[model samples]
Target: MRSIYLRITQPVIKLMLALTWSLASLQAAQAGETPIPVEKFFKSAQFKDAQLSPNAELIAFLAADNDNRSMLVIMNSKGDATPTVITRYSNLDVIFFHWVNNERLVYGISEKDLGAGEKNSGSGLFAIDKDGKNSRQLIDRFVKAGAPKFRLLPARTRFISTTGNESSDDIYVGQNSTERMNAGINLFRLNTRTGQTEIVAVPPHSIDFLFDPSGQVRIATASKNGITSVHYKENKNTEWVQLYQFDDTVEDGYSPVFIGTSGQFYVTARNGKDTAALYQYDTKSKSLIPNPLLALNGFDFDGDILFDNQQNKLAGIRYETDAHASVWFDEKDKKIQSQIDALLPNMVNLVDKGRSQDANVRLVKSFSDTHPGNYSLFNVDTSKLTQLGVVNPDIDPAKMAYRDSVRYKARDGLEIPAYITLPKGRPAKNLPLIVMVHGGPFLRGGHWNWTPAVQFLASRGYAVIEPDFRGSTGYGKKLHQAGWKQWGLAMQDDLADAREWAIKQGYADPKRVCIAGASYGGYAVLMGLIKEPDLYRCGISWVGVSDINLLYDVSWSDTAGNAWTKYGMPKLIGDQQKDAEQLQRTSPLQQASRLKNPLILAYGGADVRVPLIHGTKFYDAVKAHNSKVEWIVYPEEAHGWGLLKNNVDFWTRVEKFLDENTAVK
Candidate 1:
């Protein structure tokens, strides 16, 4: 559409851009040459979710080579005892861990079925000794089991029960189906000495269960109409005291937590205009006390109550100023604030004192994201920090560019959150932009640390933008739920709006822009190529979901099949049959011909999530349409490429593709 003068000048512009790219490309090439493997940089002593033993002499933690296959390790606190791996199942994974005694440990182990013609299997209750010696299968059969910490009660042994459809051994029968997500729970008692398991509570449909100080069961059962009624009972008595009742909507918020050693409870309740925090029954006064811990006033907080064996006062994880701060109460109601303070240090001062502001620490936890996250532990008392290593050490902080958290108003007048990383040592002008969309369409992006992909893009003289589109978690429930079925509609538009916002703010060069993402983000990349063809000159999609309809129809036999119904279907994605028209319109597979940008599609050959078929079909469809497409598949990898060679290979291909298509300089 350009005039003859502009057309004649285009060749000179292309030449100049190439010359600038080659000169800048040399400096960028040196940045990617890491001394160690990128995977090694991610590993090296980053232990997740620490659990000190009841005696506080030994500790158990989960460590992984590269956040792939995690191992359960136990080490003594004061002794010169080397940490031992109690878990050794290559095929099966340990879900949760519990200390039954000073010498024994109990955990839930299950075989994860990757849905590539695989069958979904159930997990079982497994017990191992403290020394990793006596490894025994307590359940004896495959069943859906959960981890519950055991407390040494008076006359008998007991544990906090997890309500799932567990049988005699507290394990479910088999794998869950593709359509059936609902399951019930049963309380069971296991004798440590004899390995004998007994079913204690036989409620009809117990949805959630908690154990009091005396080991008596407080169960919340859901009726057929989705109404939850809380019942408290002693021993195996049929008579139950109905303490509270609530609609299905608020049942999740009413999740029980044991607070005091004398069986006093703490729960959050909605009172009038605000959800006032309420304490459990004060038997002497026969009234509920209004909790004064104003810090955890409105937000829902949950964690293990760290008690000092005597069980006199309350101590647990609490939040303050949007950061985790621990609160513990002494006998005189003097709350001791030291544990969280010891864990999360004032890194702002450390960053100001010679360290880069781009630095971050994340606590890695098992069940909860807030529990044990990626972070360097610093002793506030001693002012000494244990460097847990970097999340992306492959990218040098000195040479690499970084982004600070930024927010812009969206088209809907909502404050859209995003991270902007400008290349280091660049003049504040119209720079080439590469918008990197995160994988989880439902997971929100934040100021937390990330991997090498973002830094790598920025190192090549391009500004990177990551928009935490709607439906992402962390902001709040309302923001998270707003993304329900807005896949290609508002969700994708948010990304485009982000790029437009960047350009309008004079942060990006409109002539040189590209979109890149992985998995769900990959789908976004292809869709960006289709929906906004002129906005982007190139795109890179790795293991992206090409067809949402195909994903809905995916079926597996064993554990994978159960996950399809239980976790996948009802949680994030809607049914394709019901949302068929929307799926077709949103899916990238149907709009392959509309892909006018230079595209690079990367896929793992053994991918079970969005199977290799998704990539294969898209590649064939695009090739048939005569679209410019580059395809790369790692034969050994599944879902994600793990090998360091594969990582370098993918990035090298990406850089070259952008250089040839887009104005990278």
Candidate 2:
């Protein structure tokens, strides 16, 4: 009986493998052909931004209709019951939400109006009960004759302090921004007995906002450009102090970490030595104590100072190092090596357990180099994880290869981290590689998931390498700050270095390397082919910013504001006027003639960030050079390919381009 069962199962598995290979081959041959419903992917049944309800018994997440109209939905804890929409606004999108009580949820809504670049416009507050009842706007917009009156502060703070225990906690909300932009938030107090709402903290900007462990507001953090102060009415005596004041060179306050019991404030700061160390400001002593846990120079880790307010016995601190997780035993003055081992395995198990419950969790659990992010949740108490969902699960896993994270010392002695995914069922030597750079030149990179593009290329048998080069977030501030003035210089070198590292590691062939990315990543791809033409066989850029100067060259009518200057332009890409030559050297358009590699460019017609002009200008320049370039424009799309048809179409063209141009073994 056992032998017969094995015989039957083995044959079935072998047949399935054969069928998968056949489908892959067919898909490859028809790489340029359109398959599946084009509009189906754009339907926005795609769920995003999920938050567990306050009670932890239900989850309130955002869902969308076929038109991409978003609504708030509530599901049971286990996600067993059908999801019910608490909202039905077709033109409105729920940007974010917070659970008010077990029965009601509050959210910020913004209209889906585009083209004007008004991101914050049409934003207002609303309240809805969990059962899809009593949905009403907390505030509404009105157009009056001749003139209008308005304030940034909300009429109430119901959303911030939702847990019914607001009275016991002292609440404050606006303390971060230096200038109060019309008190941009509303504060409200809800009387539980009569359900009457009263005005609480009037906004423009609170000096600071504080919250307790139960997600309750306890204190407000206040600061001024010239003054360092903590304002709290403690023991009936309201006193303020000039904590540690800095020279005018200092900018911004530390994101305050509150110690619940003593209400002490802790912050991480670099002292005279230019090394980061944790400093605790005692509420009673009014003195600052340097924490020993983070005494190491040139290195920093986020130490969660968990405290059991009831016991006051510092509940131990946990932190992660370069490759290992560590925990600090406060009282013992030593780190718990065993505790780190215990925590990771449990976390892993929780993740593994979650896969069985939610498809999201399961997807994340099965994340590979070729895939994108999968979602899973692990419960600390139960030591179990629930898989919530997975994206693009229809793609067969066997047709893809898993990537391993690798770290290599760059020429500058910087430890660069990257992930290289080999083609499925292919030998390691002489494989074509797509050196993919991540967007956010300032953000983090390549996490586990089912990457349609990566898998699609791997299916055509091209190894893909994604490097989270220097400037990536989640590593530390030092690494991020390093890429400040080195946009096209070091950043471009990092991409090139990845190819060399891969070649040295015996994972890739130097002759058939291609560079690919979208947005900032797209720009990286263009830079790769231009700056290191000999290293790349081809390149792909989708909605990439080509001209650095043109990024800020916009019409007055555009509401994007001076975001480049306001957000990161000063520290990241450099001021346009000051670094004119550097920006010109880095601009892809300036070096378009040097791009010898075959190129594929895709852009959204409505992409205001990079704009259609970016692609058009680059294409025109490439044409002027009489270069071999392929270009495609999606008329209805915005910054990204919202329609699934476009995504599949672009990939199909990409597969054909890579296959025809390069030798993929």
Candidate 3:
């Protein structure tokens, strides 16, 4: 029932001072029912991420400091020792980090101040002790011109994962060769302190690797010419034998999960079913078990297995349905979960245990549709829960909107899953609506949790609906495959269907709907305006693709050279040459003159995926006829806004735009 404040250093005090000024400015800008400022929704969380030491004695986390830079800090889980500032940088921020062992941790850094266009350095890795000693650079941030030769690993080298054995300092790293995009990675066993590495056995053309609980490479998946071959080895002494192969374009076969201590191989497979389920793999027979280990009714197997290192056994399985949940095979852990739930009955409480069974402290992350989430330490011995930190301290669950999972049938009768977030303190009828499309038309969109962008719109009195249209993943094979080659055609229809569904349900005003998204979702925004101008009064698209053909034609884009463009796009999204007619017909660039809705088009100048050209060309075409169009470009940003200042400015503009176009008279 008590809260423990972690000890802070002088730099963190400066960070608090900076946060005060930033928040003061935000408060000065707030007004009306939506008292929460735009900055509150877009600003980085005070506590970015956290992890417990193997023994659960210490906790390491990334915290944003005074300059809005993410710094690495360590604190005692027992709240007894002074928290140590492990890594501090004025310009760069610690982006990714992990505890290598009980005493040492490793992290990767990036330039937070620079946009993707201006960022020239790579994310180099470094290691330091928990006590803020024995600091060493394991990889070079960038290869400086005429720099002296050094022992540090190349900038291209990346830390994959820590060896499960917390007693040792050795970890696994992967380094790609000169032909990085197309070639397999050279696996290495790296020592943190010594900077020495030994080459590990890797399957030919392997793109991914999986290791057992004992830190032995047991499975490798290799991709070549659209075919994915899974290779497996019983031990380090044995050769990797080819298990099975499947076409990358087709949805078939099983994916390797993790090897159990008992040498049982676990995997996830559809097994001739619509949704994927967890099953044990029969190595000898090269097939999945007849019965699934775990399965969900409507959702696919989209989570990881929890292994208890001390007991050398599978403890539980953590998966996602409408929300994240865990199934514990062990009775004691189940009892612990029940207790945590009883204490935090209103939210979803996820319990994470340290590798050492002797560790009494369990890290709990609890959140709900209205809550952004908070991290806490649950002491088993004292039967007490002490709060560590909240993700967004400024967010109030009382003012935030409620997100509900929904489903509606498309024109062809295929059920499309969606999420609808209704504005707080408002009746679920005749509200202004925003059909917010997700970027990855091929990936899953929303989950049953707190989302900043969605909440921000809802706070402004707009009902937001995110449709996991035909091409989106995570639902089942039917929904995913049905989206192939639909792009601006069927995929665009799904957004309109979602809008119609909301209006029919009396949750939206039929005349007050707007469409908005980024990337592919941005593309959908333009297409929605073009194909169904009467349905939407306005449209907002940022860093969106205007021409489908440009996805293949634009060589400067990072997407140009990848496997997705070469193989996946040709099959799933319409081939460049063979389907040129369809591509041109669906392209927003070709039909821009047809769009007459009030529109806002924003693009990141440094975006490599859907470059600024997509926006500039479409603007030129649409602006010639439509005088209501507003165009803005962030030269420093790429793909999406990275800086908090940019995010605040962009969303504030969005708030004004939505009110001007869709607000009730």
Candidate 4:
């Protein structure tokens, strides 16, 4: 490739950056009718996350400042138009925060690291008053370049609970144990006012902790091999009792532990059913109730049990299948939910309880399969839903593509669930398809909402297919279990199934179809080409696992080579000794010689999960045999592209690649 002036020349590159940023700003579709620019989708949301204060008198939201840095803004219920920029960071992204009370809030900052291992995100906790006054750094996570080494707590070291009133200055914080991997987690009551922390409770070394709304440590999960020990306690004074030990070898492990609002232990386990369903455990007797609290018809109930903190009542159980739905337990709240649903029948209305004493003003976020999200302040007193502001104001709901949940049976007669997205105002028939697989094969695959990736592909006049496949969680234990130890085998088959289904439905042009994904999905992309060589016309794999053995080899990487992966990989993925032959066959690097399709392979330099080694090793191997593979790398990126410029650059390459290969048939 010739050195392009826009990329190689420093002066021209600076000029291009100025030109690109300028073009990004001047876009507004009359009716979402014009093809939305790639930058529009990649641009940071005007408001990332917003929350109403305890009193509902004020709203706290995260928005980019003048320098494109994340900041917290405080405003009245009318919206943060003339808002007070309470907190600002030059580099860090204000990812998450919750109001400590009506007057105070604690927030955590994060840099763009989807899989940044050991690159301290400056996630240290901070607290501030409503006026942006008296801001204090409670926990300092930042480190100077040549400063003395100080170990950082877990990225999830977070505020566990707050009283939701101004009276309580102390917020419960969950800190990770610095000593051992087995030391489950420690709890501390940090005074937001005085910047002092009090050790509240410390549980035995385990993987994670389970706490109730009242700031009580109820359950702890410990792991050895694949067997996870669930330990529970009645109260703070009692000794921890063993609830049950589960072996993950069977399926992604049929288990879900959470403290329900009903004052009973809510768990999801396969008691007598094939799929893990909701079950209530008796804390007093230390036994399961043998019956489900709430079980859906087909899908596994995989949502939170709504708890009204102020009123101290169980609101309802919300779950997702084709789309998100809820079953309200509280009659009054149920009626309210029904009325809201009637009002916004096209969109799903997620209701969050208010922090006020009366709990009358509920915060509702309404969104549809096509639309992004709308923040609405629901006034319970007047039963009125007022539109506060949108998440992405540039995205017009009417101009977005149509998304539908579709189900198809795999070769083994197992029902496969997937989501299909079609371009707006375009004929769905004979469309080019991009089989976009989700990264976590164990987690839920596709959500029924406005996903930028899917919508972006759809905007380019291509149909997008995302299959949950077997082994994906939030569906059922059977499907999840079916994916156990099958990595590229059954999982790859599911991808093929999704493609064939789309072709059969007359929605996908078989000749113009391609494969693309990140992480494990990227691994699947490479394997799909290996297994079904003629199926896909092209492959785009970024930050993908090239070898199954790398999962165990890369131990220094935090999430990749950790306590949980060691014990779980043998059962969930594959045993190195037992399934060596299968793993060898599945490894993308080993089968690089088989590559013949036009492929775009990219990786993050600091990607610990799917490290740069995976990309380099595979790239070299492929280059030795067939040098047709186009390769790229984001030096500062961790896992996927998090920065705005990198994302736009990636999609620009993708759009150009698809246009070259999977052009409109």
Worst 10 residues of 2 by lDDT: 1-10
TM-scores of the candidates are 0.67, 0.69, 0.93, 0.88
Residue 574 of candidate 3: its Cα lDDT?
97
- Model 2 agreement with the true structure over 1-665: per-residue lDDT tens digits: 00000011111101122223455545553564333332322233345556554345677677666676677888776646777887867777776776666667667776553422333344555667788777665543332344322323343222455433322222222212323321233445543322345554422334454454444444444333333344332321344333444321234234445545345565555544333455565556655554433443333434455444444444444332222222333432222223222442312111211101222221113233333323544443353545555434444444456655566676797877676777655456778889898887776675443456666666666788888787775445556666777777888888888989988878788888889999888999888888878889899899898977777665421223433343456457777788888889999999888887789999887676778888999998897665578989987677777555677688778878887778744
- The residue pairs found clashing in candidate 3 are none
Better of 3 and 4 by lDDT: 3
List runs of model 3 lying over 4 Å from the truth: 1-31, 145-148
RMSD (Cα, Å) of model 3: 7.4
Per residue, candidate 1 scores C-alpha lDDT tens digits across 122-156 of: 34556677778767655533223554324221211
Number of the predicted model whose lDDT against the real structure is largest: 3
Cα miss at 394, model 1 (Å)?
7.0
Question: lDDT of each prediction vs. the true structure?
Answer: 0.56, 0.58, 0.83, 0.75
User: Model 4, which residues run further than 4 Å from truth?
Assistant: 1-34, 77-82, 89-93, 110-121, 144-160, 163-166, 178-183, 251-262, 309-311, 559-561
Instruction: Tell me the tens digit of each residue's lDDT in model 4 across 1-665.
Output: 01101111111001111122222222332134456788888777766677878667888888877776778988787443677888887767787788887789988887753335436555777889998888776766654555432332334466676743456777877766664344455777778878666776544566566766655667777775556777777777878888777666644333545674345677776666665666677767767776677665556767777666666655567666567767776677788887887777668788876555356666788887667888777777778887766878888766677677767899999888788887766556898999998997788878778888888888878899999988887666678888988888888998998999999999999999999999999999999887787999999999998998987887656555455566777778898998899999899889988988888999988877678998999998888766658899988788888777788899989999989987644
Query: All candidates: CA RMSD in angstroms?
Result: 12.2, 9.8, 7.4, 10.1
How far is 656's C-alpha from truth in model 2 (Å)?
2.7
Residue 545 accuracy (lDDT) in model 4: 88
